[model samples]
Target: MSSSSLEYKLIKENNSTQGISIEGWKIVTKKLPILNSQEIEKVQKEILVPLPEMFFGNNSLSVSNDDYGVLFEFSPIDALKLVDSTKEGGEKVKVAYSEEWTLKSSKNHEHIKDVIKPYDWTYSTLYSGTLKIASKGQKFEKTTERIDIEKLKIPEPILFYDEIMLFEDELADNGTAVLSAKVRVMESGFFILQRFFLRVDDVLFKMNETRVYHEFGTKSLLKEYSSREEHYFKIKAQIPVYKGDDISQLTNPDWVSSKLTNSEELILENLNLLGGNYSKI
Candidate 1:
């Protein structure tokens, strides 16, 4: 599983795209500027949803194992599409300032040129990476398995790493919403994390995370998706006494995630990379 034994290749493009191919596995990341007006309009039309204030429509990250013929991709378009539109009542997120923003935009009546539309301003998404399988009879199955966090903490040297931001919005200045993905490769294997964080100043804080792990020379991979949320004041109370009013810790995703007591299990599954290698783990 060491780098010396693998055919590892790194491809870098002028447009800020990078790719790593090793041992029949490929990981690619693209970081581009925010979409122009025309690109935003096109995406809005196709997605039929309000684009975020700062939308990076061209950003994306993808990982695939040629041995299994499976590709997992993360993109702004696909991630935002999963956000609940105004029509979808289930798990709809509306912050305290949602009403204030809408009312202020309508105050001018007919004279106003544009009015703010009502949707999940927080941009909460349960996106756990899109999966595509090209090989027949190979698929992901539910399992009680979990990533070996203890193993990952064993201090192995990281061979490759990259982080990419998919999209973000200020939530009308009420708070912030951001979605990002990162990956790290090690001699034992690799790990991928896609996280979405939302914070509403006085209302709530939320996080949705997807973790994928693949051991070197293995024929399968494991993925776990989980969500955690808590009211704003409750998490704020967890801040250290000396750090009061600073609120810097609240902006940290890792800190806020650890304080979120309300937890939910969204998805737990494992995929067999090679055909007929379905022995349960």
Candidate 2:
């Protein structure tokens, strides 16, 4: 629990409202109802294959069969901490966790130009590309919109697993921008909360939003997080944080928000676990 050059501040209620900002911060929320790796892989390979098609909706985007072998792999470089809260519910779940996860993609793509051109960048925390914004008709030469990652009190922080599962998502979602963007574009950091096994007093529930970059990209595309406001977004599902006790519960309050209804069924089917059903499939 000793962090080098880490500063601590008690964020009060007044500070909670009006966008919580972090300098050089990345917020990772991991939803693990079926914490089994093989089940997760099955969801990624079988269930998610059709998502990009659903996400892009008619834009021509695909990988050559040969590209598949080279394009996907897992890495341990990604770190994890319990997200104090998240956008999983119609509102933030004060009781359970929200983990931050990203879809790992190899820079090599199907975009063949006789000679392939690779953008000399690996990861993006938030979509902070200045040139891409200009293409969208912005006034400034460069202005990065600071995303709001909630402020929380992390007791102890640690890496989630020895190795994080990395894979390519067929669909690339630019937040709410997914509703548009007809052409097939691979989404970075687009994720869903399938389900969770909750304990309000869970050891992993407390976490701090690490001071990190808006995203990882080309040297030019990497912009420092500025406090100025550019564009504002008001989501329909705006849930606030709450206070809670150290208690166990049978049902996750945010079960309705889960994309996977068969989490318990998958667990029982794969692992033959039949007793506990916090949010049983």
Candidate number with greatest TM-score? 1
Q: Clashes in model 1: which pairs?
A: none
For candidate 1, the 10 contiguous residues with the lowest summed lDDT are 108-117
lDDT of 1 at 46: 73
Full-model lDDT, candidate 1: 0.78
**What would you estimate as the lDDT of candidate 2?**
0.19
Candidate 1 lDDT over residue span 120-166, tens digit each: 65788888888765454666789898899899999877768999888
Highest lDDT against the true fold, candidate: 1
The reply for model 1, stretches above 4 Å from the true place, is 1-5, 87-91, 94-117, 276-281
The residue ranges of model 2 lying beyond 4 angstroms of the native Cα positions read 1-3, 8-22, 29-31, 35-163, 166-281
In model 2, the Cα lDDT at residue 50 comes to 20
